[model samples]
Target: MSRRTLLQNAAIAGAAAVPVLLAGARSAGAKMSQTAVAYQGSPKGSSKCSNCKLFEPPSSCKSVAGDISPNGWCKIWVKA
Candidate 1:
């Protein structure tokens, strides 16, 4: 292949690989530590895990590691 053709093909391949790499990164979502989000066992005002969008039912959180309490509060808490 010519030098220009080789570079063009490489660019195209790199562009194609970008979406795959981004998809993998998006799928591999990492949760933050409780301390990183300033998580507390008790609710902060009206904000609580049960009312937060990231809170999973029972005793878990989608964005916070370890068992989460429904009455707990965190800096990342978003209203449901």
Candidate 2:
């Protein structure tokens, strides 16, 4: 019951709760619509979601749901 032990226990508990919290948050937003993002062709570097690191092959994005275009661009687009 020392101060260090209490802090350690608190840290362990907090770490253990992180994944649960993240899972809940993820599920809470699981219904988000991909159409809301309104992806378009990038005007800056001509970058597309297909070339992004978050892009999932065959028409999907890690951050986007539904059918996504290879040439589509969004606000969260990042270079691969």
Best by lDDT: 1
How well does candidate 2 score on lDDT at residue 39?
Answer: 70
The C-alpha stretches of model 1 lying farther than 4 A from their native spots are 1-27
Candidate 2: pairs in clash = none
Tens-digit lDDT string for candidate 1 (4-67): 9999999999999976764574368866688978999999998999999989999999878899
* Candidate 2, 1-80: lDDT as tens digits: 99999999999999999768655755776623465556764433677887788688888877667777787787666799
Candidate 2 contains a number of clashing pairs equal to 0
Clashing pairs in 1: none
